[model samples]
Target chain A: MEAAPPESAAPITPVLVAEHLERKLPGDPPVTLVTDIDLAIEPGKFTAIVGPSGCGKSSLLYLLGLIDRPTDGRLLLEGRDMMPLSGDERAQIRLRHFGFVFQFHFLLPEFTALDNVMMPIRRLGRLSLPGARERASDLLTSMGLGDKLHKPPDHLSGGERQRVAIARAMANNPLLVLGDEPTGNLDSTNSARVVELFRELAHEQGRAVVCVTHDPGIAEVADIRVSMLDGRICEVLRQT
Target chain B: MFPRLGLLLHIAAMHLLVRRRQTLVATSGVAVGVGFFLAVSALMVGSQTDFVKTLIAAAPHIIISDELRSPSPQPGVREYGKTGAVELHGYKVRNEVRGIKDWQQILREIDAMPGAIGSPSLSGAVTLRQGGRDEPLGVVGIDPTIETRVSTISEKLRAGRLIDLERVQGGVIIGEDLAERLGLGMGDIVAATSARGVSRSLRIVGLFKKGQSGLGSGTGYMLLREAQSLLGRPFVINRLGVKLPDPYTADAVAKQLEARHGYKAESWQERSADFLGLLLTRNVIMYTVVSAILLVASFGIYTAVSNSVTDKRRDIAIMRSMGFSQGDLQFVFVVEGMALAVAGVIAGWLFGFALMTVLGSLEFPIQGEVRHLPLDRSTRQYLIAAAASLFAGIFAAWLPARKTALVDPVDILRGAV
Candidate 1:
């Protein structure tokens, strides 16, 4: 694996781009979730999508994460059009190149933190059992969850569970880590800690971190902040 | 791919383990179903086997009779090689001796056939007269050495060997029931009158029991020469009994012989077709009724997996978001169903075998003979039962597993979180 790029290095090409992306749900009057959205996500950067509830922040995040298809637009992953790919091919892309952390910290309660982290690694089928265990342990340890590796989600605290979810998202060493309100259920201090970890994952480890949030404090730590209103991006601000 | 499938199986197993009570209930349901299926199969198949065995033991595989099934050409009317233009007026059928002419040549041909043992027999209706008590009976004349090869009666003799019939010229072997009814013992002289009204005094040298009262009380066996003299048919035999190594091939062999010899050769299978058909219908009904149990048990599996799928919707969405494909989600639940089915099948086989053993050990009277319950021991029955349960389990799991696989993560996540 390549080492994380330094923050001061020369600019690199964007790994993911969405051009005029749109999503609409059929209804008596069709409900447009996100429309006319254009965004480019670069490696070694933390980007925040901040919006109020019902403003389609999570919807846009899902589209970019490949969890949901765009209604009408082109999505490019590594400059290759992802719209033409089949569902299974898209799933393969997600499995290899992207990881997702949801707001509820949806760790499988039956499994311990270590086993939960090993899920993606095992699904990818690139690592041996022992290798997966070692990598999961290392990821958890880096997240300051070394002592809580054996605890199931039901036994872990809210903050510890969310951190475990984050460790799981990074299990396959994905190029893009997408989080939808990852700190929405966390306390202030825990949320701050999670925000700092997200920054380190982007700036130090050279992976792109895209997080949807309602907290202004989390947006303050991002290299770029995107604000959405009425299903459209109102502003894109470069913070640093 | 195997390792990935293994992971899916592990996940499935863990899901079942976490809900141990539900899993046990489902597994036990299938086990009970499979166990009953196997037990019923064993009983049904075993009874059929016993029935065929009893039938084979009672008669020869094929019986060729001297009487032609179709009428022969009338005398004075030339047929086949000659031109038949002369018709006789007031022609009547002659009363001739009821016996096979040229039977020695026929028997030679039959005995020459592969896997065939042919024995000439003289059978006629007779009256047993002992101290004015007259009882109607069927008498069979058998060559002791040859008849022993074609029929089981020689093995079933109780009082004397079949060779005694050959040693003593007028020796007779009567059934025990017949002997008791006549109040006659061995060495007692009994007068037998044939259908042609020829009377002869015979010494009862042996008593045999045929296991059924109908056959045992009405049949008698005697030497061939004595029977021919009593029946007033000299140097003639009416029936040829043939035994074959493979009784099921009797029909083909009988057909071949009948076609060649122009005699009515009846195979035991042809004679017992109705009984065999009854057995087949009984088997179909048995399997249909038994398979219903497995179907009911599969419903139990469906219910358990359906409940799990409904309860694990959020987990499914999360896994999907984490890049698990729809096939993976479906495989996990399918594996769960198969695991339960496999466990149940194993337990069922043991339970079924145990049940068969217990039943087989118990003895009861059947047709005046002590016999144990017949239980088939072939592995085919077990495999069929297992395969049935597995198929049912997988079918039951399919809908719910597919539902789990097709779940949209966005809809679930938007509503849930």
Candidate 2:
């Protein structure tokens, strides 16, 4: 697989930062999901978090994506403290600045690919219906899914479905894109194609991309890799 | 805002479409409830209005009687009021002539009241004797011109005009059935004796038919002056029949009259209180039964929504991760429920209208007359049915919508994928 190119000459600015984050589920003996996690995600870089099963890779990704709250930490989005925000405020921030993809495409089966991509655009309510439709079409076409926009998720193949989900995640022009094993369900060729697309999304569009994966191929293509062991980050690898 | 709302509606419609069978079942449940509610309410309200119309047409809105509900003190007792409270042995109550003294002045006062037209009348018991056959009858004395304004007696005349009684002195209007029973006709003279034994021969000038057996066979009308002379009670009126522009205000008007004037004024509604009370009770029972149907339909909605929520758990988690708020999820489901209710309401209205039209076209015997079934096509009944169905659907969907809104997307995602 061809590795992603190094960062351009433009100075890097961090889009998301986490300091001393800790997540513990309430129990007789609290189950710690992640601990002492400190990270900064810069724009125009593709980062991969790799770990064995149950080693907090997905948990750390969820925390970074703002989908899960940490028990003790300060998370800053674009240098603004996100901990004091209300649930609705956090949702608004997610709508404007963050996008997510899961291992399962998670596209609503009842909606056409175009509608699924338009979901975030319509939810943000910044675009008219025609505008949203146009934007969704553009994104799908960019993902090489022009002909399949009107098809339902069930009608599409696995790679097509994941690509549709990616187009949906980028619908609102979010600053950061987070994926949890997005290519885990794809074959080798489709997984390599998805990783190439992620690298292009980060380098060409100047957006931060963070993905959690066990696939060594995905980590090899990423510009930076963070490995986790027993709920803690154990190693950081950067490819020049 | 419009785009967001459209998206929510789109999603809600899509969810419902995914489970078309359950949607149909729930919608039909509400439809049936609303349909029955409209049909039954229209029938009951229609019959009530029809009965009231007949009652209003049959009699005056208010009747002021000269006789007091309680006995008046004797002149001697009034003159020696409370003098040592003397108790008399063998005291007996004697029946005296009952008539309104100074009734012309009272009539003038009543006529001056707003929206009121009062006519003096004297009703007494008499017997008609013709061909050696005697039948007991009620003799009503009325002024031809004033009585026509207060009662529908003029419209009921079968042979001659009520005004014809004025042209012929000592002329009376008898019901067609009464005239037939007595073997008498217009221009025929019949011997009549008052309860006081005063006897006279009166000519039948007009015949009236009211479609009621008792009224047709036992009542007669004559000139007020002639009836007073024959009954040995000249210059006396025992009753005042009153008509108003709006008959529904009769009770309030009657109360006002009774308070101002000491005569016992009774409204038509007051006279028929027992029947009206029965009608009201029937209405209560009908609403209870129909509301139970809606309640059952609401349970159908509840189950349908609950099932949808369970099936859409993964989709819900996905939407939440896509940045949809809790209110958005709740709004989508609630919109689904409201859509079903609205569709059902429309269907029910059409169903009820069709039923009413069919029923109204059929003829049935009612009180010896063939008529169409009463079915009120009032918009109020439609609104009530719609409002009830909507309320039930929303209430039923509330629990499931709340549950769906409170769903933890992480929990669902962890288990689902």
RMSD, candidate 1, Å: 2.9
For model 1, residues B97-169, the per-residue Cα lDDT tens digits are 6688878998888778787888999988889999889988788888999877777776677789888998886
Provide the lowest-lDDT 10-residue window in model 1 chain A.
A1-10
Give per-residue CA lDDT, model 1, range A134-225, as digits (tens): 99999999989999999989999999999999999999899999998889899999999999989999999999999999988889989989
Q: Whole-model Cα lDDT per candidate? A: 0.87, 0.87
For candidate 1, list the clashing residue pairs, or say none.
none
**Per-prediction DockQ, in order?**
0.70, 0.68
Model 2, range A1-240, lDDT digits (tens) per residue? 122124635456578888899999999899999999988788888999999999998888888877789999989887889999877787888888988988999999999999999999999999999999999999999999999999999999999999999999999999999999999999999999899989999999989999999899989989989999999999978787
Docking class of 1: medium
Clashes of each: 0, 0
Pairs of residues at least 3 apart in sequence or in different chains that clash in candidate 2: none
